[model samples]
Target: MVRTRLINHPLVVGLLEIAAGEIGYEHRGMIRVLCDVEQFRQTIDLVVEGD
Candidate 1:
């Protein structure tokens, strides 16, 4: 959600938690996506549901 530099890269899929909902995966080779941290934080409460 946020434009963050991943502090950790070796995160396993199981270990890395993702919010429940649909994501627009525009590219397959896109390893990461960037968004405003503030915007993400604001919408997080409404977006984040169960894992």
Candidate 2:
């Protein structure tokens, strides 16, 4: 999934660490992003923009 790809990036990993306690994996390699939706979106946006 998108998160799996994002997780490969150091920048995204650092940003995700802010909410690491809340983030987890679900069944079949799916990730559960339980942090602020806006913040998560921004993280993805930052990584995508960087690419």
At residue 43, give the lDDT of candidate 2.
Answer: 74
Instruction: Show pairs that collide, candidate 2.
Output: none
What's the C-alpha lDDT at position 39 in model 1?
Answer: 46
Task: For residue 5, give model 2's deviation from the true position in Å.
Answer: 2.9
Q: In candidate 1, what are the lDDT values of residues 1-51, reduced to their tens digit?
A: 322333243232212333211243443554432445564454443334311
TM-scores for all candidates?
A: 0.27, 0.55
Q: Which candidate number would show the highest lDDT if scored against the true structure?
A: 2
Residue 36 lDDT (model 1)? 52
Largest TM-score belongs to which candidate? 2
lDDT (C-alpha) at residue 44 in model 2: 83
The 10-residue segment of model 1 with minimum total lDDT is 12-21
Clash tally, candidates in order: 0, 0
Per-residue lDDT over 1-51 for candidate 2, one digit per residue giving the tens place of the 0 to 100 score: 364666878867665565465553333453455567787788788889988
Cα lDDT listed for each candidate: 0.35, 0.66
